[model samples]
Target: MKKISEKIVRLRIVVIVLVFLITIGLGYFIPRLKVNPDVMSYLPKDDAVAMQFEDVGKRFGGNQTVIVGVKSDDIFTEKTLSLIRDITDSLRVTDGIRSVVSLTNIIDIREVDSVLTVSNLIDEYEIPSEPKDLDSIRQYTMSKDLYNGFIVSADSKMTMIAAKIEQEITETIDTNLTGKALMVYYADKYPGKMYEFEQDADTMKIKINKAAVADQIRDKLRTDFPDAELYFGGLSFMVQDIGDIIMHDIMLLGPIAFLFILMALYLGFRNFRGVFLPVLTVLIAIIWTLGLMAILGYEITLVSNVTPIILLAVGSAYTIHVVNRIGMEERNGGNYKENIVAALKYIIIPVFLAAVTTMIGFLSFIYGSYLTMIRDFGIFTAIGVVFSLILSLSFAPAVISYFPPKKRTKTEDKPEKGIIAAMLMFFYRLSVFRGKWVILAWIILAGVMTFGGFKLERRVDLLD
Candidate 1:
């Protein structure tokens, strides 16, 4: 260890250059990092519930359905009806849309010459223009159980356009299932599927990108009905919104956290090396971890979005310890090289032990969780901790050896009566005098937090 430290200091420039090149190379993967906010995709594939859910998706249509709600003072108005018609028409033609159900597209059952006839509520070429026409349409819609509450709101002031998106079928279908059986099933289930089957027998299995389809519908609604009060609800829209929000939070929170860390470090250390070296070490760890995730083809998920922040928080501690130890040793009369070696010898074992235990704690999540995102979070964070430990042991000491802390006289060794000092003294006295009470309070707080954590429910609804 001593020989390695000597070599590191002797080849400090080379070590620094190598570290820079490696970090830069890893940083290249930053742009390539994919963000996936689909909550369903995070479910463990081997989990029975997840497999069953996927099977359900495969048998039926995709789970990605978007409900677009349009509100107005009077939805029965000619203008409102016309806008609904236009929007429904546009959505029907949207790519990857399996089906669209709205006031305009929904089926209306009627007795035509004593024969039951089923047709679209609003014809493509015809829209309700008069008050009487809209009144009749509204009456018929309200009368139907399927349309009421599902498509048209009870109050009739708001209507929902439900669009079913088709997901891409990546797996091959059962080859044993004959086309004739599929055609018969389609004929009995969906009349429209009969025509599709007739057009192409292979059309029994269809593939479509549900997310892209949802994006198209959302874009159309935003572009064409900009003035309308549109509330998009459902799995697809929720997924998209969740993705956007996660990204926004990542962008907004990351810098804020960095600034806070910077301020805290600056105030504590009162020196550039003290603040800069620890931050830089943590930054490198974060970049390396994220880049590794990208290289491994793991998408950044909502759960894993906190990786950078976690790394920043956890990784900085070792560097701080190393920096302080080296500073203390130097101030106590050791030369730069000797202090660097001595600091490493004293701190490396504890730092490594702390890092290993923390990593083991994180790794427990990987073993315990059935969710991919949680497992990925565990793996990446553990990796980041490892990187921090390595850099703190190697690069940190190497760098600090070049910029040693100035020697302090005996007078400077005495604690100053500053605000920070006063606060520390107060805390020290409190801990000494009220140690038993403080411990009891902490235990009670921990118990309350644990009980509260168990009571907290998992929220799938992003809107809530």
Candidate 2:
């Protein structure tokens, strides 16, 4: 410990410069980090539910379906019917669309000369202008069990156009027993093997960017019908909305939290170095942690989204403790080297012990959690805590040694008598006068909260 303190004081400038350069290099990767809002993507690939989901997609084609709802006072009007037909035609010709189901595309079953025949309810370029034609079309649609409640609503005022997506397929042979069994099962179920997984020239092998596709559809609808009302619903839209909200909170709340911490530190220390050093330590830790995440091929998800805030809240405490100790030693008539060495010697073991315990607490999540998001959160937060401890012990003292605090006079060392002091005194008096009752009340409250927490239900609704 003494040798480390001597080395830090001797090589303070070199350490500061190295840390600055490394921080800048890591900051470059911050913009490259990707945000993934897909909750299912966070599940481990070997998880049963995730494997089943992939199997279903492979056997039945892409599971993603987009629903376009068209609203109007009456859907039977000639103009509304024409609009529907136009939208259906446009969607049918759009890329990435496997099939479109709507009134314009669905077939009508009929008996022609004692022979069953199927024909489109609305032929291409055939607009229903007459009331009789519209009525006939309505009667046919409402009577059919397939399209009655699936495509058209019960209110007769809203209709839906469902587009099934055929995602681009990537071929890979699986050697696992489960994969082999699934392949055999699927082959046996479909005798002719009509659904062969093949790469299509027009389809993407990777997951389709549903949000981008939804935006394109929305733009087209808005351009074609300026006054029409439309609502988009799908898994992709929900994921996109979640990503937007996460980004908004990070941008708005992150800086607000930093400002609040800054205010608190400045008011407490009344010294610029004391306020700046702790904030700088936490900032660098966050940058390094997030950069490491990007390099490890991890995307930011809902659970890991709060990592920066967590590091900021937890990492600053180590530096604050060390800085306060050094400040107190200098005020009591210690020289720069003596003050720093004494601070490091006294707090080094306790700080290391605290960091280790905190890291162990976070690492517990890795074993307790089934979700990949929570596991990644644990891993990254533990790394941040380590970085915080290292910076507090090495970089913090090195910087402080170079810019030693000025000796405080007797007047400056006096206790504060401000509103903060008054509040502290009041709390102290209460604790001394009513210590037993206060302890009893806290125990009861904690037990009630713990029991209530255990009864809480888990909800995974992304849209809400």
Candidate 3:
């Protein structure tokens, strides 16, 4: 051990350089990291929600939809009606929409020349170029019993131009659509292109929106037609907003947390090296782990985001404990070689136990029903735990030795007290109790907890 320290001291610069080179080399070979955007990926395949979503997606062809409602004070007025027509017309031409339903596309059964003629008011068979012709069509559109307020507002406050978006339509709307009514009109004309529709004389139903698709369309619409009152509803829209929120939080929270960790280290150790050295070690291990995941093609999901921070917090503890021991040893008159040995010997067993137990706590979660993300967390964190242990054992000792303090006369030992103290206090209190009484108390507590366990109720799925 003495010879090893002397040789390392002689090659201090080489060891430090090698550590940096190794970190950089490993990082380069590891691939860029990516995250799986779908939060559902972490859910178990056999889970009810997973099964339902899969079934709906396959059978009904995407239960997602994008609803566009146009509101005005008096939508039944000629001007507002014209606006509805214009909007519906624009939507009909929009790419990727499966179906569109508005007052414009509804059919009416009317007595024409004393005979009932069933035809769409806005039929492609006849093109009305003038207001008079449009008004004639409107008269028929209004008289029909089927043209209920479902397609229009009762008090004429608003009307809807809805689109059922296909999964492929998400790709198309992202690539091709333009105009405020692109979704509406697109669904109207190409209703059969990607998905089916349901009509209840007045109400229009189309396939749901896909998140990526809905968001692109929403952002473009919001930007280009800032004044347009757009009402977007559907599963796709919901997922799109969630994705945006995740990104926003990542941007806002990640850096602030890093700064907080740095501050914590600085407060604990009052020195530049004390604060940075340990942080650097954890960062290296995390980068290597994530890089390996990227190279191995594992997609990070929502749960994976928490692992890096957990690694940073827990991994730093081992380093700090070692550095604190080294600092204490230098203050108490011990040489670098002896202090390094003392710190490693003292911390190794305790830190190993802590790291192992913490890892077990994470690993136990693998027994959960839906554990894809948790599984990744367990594996990566276990790897980090190993790296932290290694660095604490080797690199930390080497670094501290390179900057060792002058030797002193006496080396005093610090006793481990917290847990031992609590145990002793508990034993002292229990000294008054008879052995039979203690056993009886334990039996009673166990019985009470067992009774409570049976009272636990299973949760219900509202959608189910």
Could you give the candidate ranking by TM-score, starting with the highest? 2, 1, 3
**Higher lDDT: candidate 1 or 2?**
1
User: 1-464, model 1: which lDDT tens digit per residue?
Assistant: 67766776778788788889989999998898977777887888889998999888767876678888899998878888888888888888776677788877677788999999998887746775777877887888889888778777889899988887765433233466665775576456434311223323344544443444566678878998889888888877777777788899889988988899899898788889989999999999898988898888888888889888888888999999999888877876757788788777788788889999999988989777877899888988999999999888878887887775666777877877777878989999989999999999999999999999999987655667
Tens-digit lDDT track of model 2 for 311-375: 88889989999999888778767588888888788889889999999999999999968788899
The estimated TM-scores of all candidates read 0.86, 0.87, 0.64
The lDDT of each candidate is: 0.80, 0.80, 0.65
Query: For candidate 3, which ten residues in a row score worst on lDDT?
Result: 168-177
The predicted structure with the larger lDDT, 2 or 3, is 2
Clashing pairs in 1: none
Q: Tell me the spans in candidate 3 whose CA falls farther than 4 Å from its real position.
A: 1-22, 25-31, 41-52, 77-97, 106-161, 168-209, 406-464
Q: After superposition, how far is residue 318 of candidate 1 from its true place, in Å?
A: 0.6
Model 3, 55-78: lDDT tens digits are 776576455566667788755555
For TM-score, the strongest prediction is 2
Runs of candidate 1 with Cα error greater than 4 angstroms are 110-114, 169-209, 409-411, 443-460
lDDT-best of 1 and 3? 1
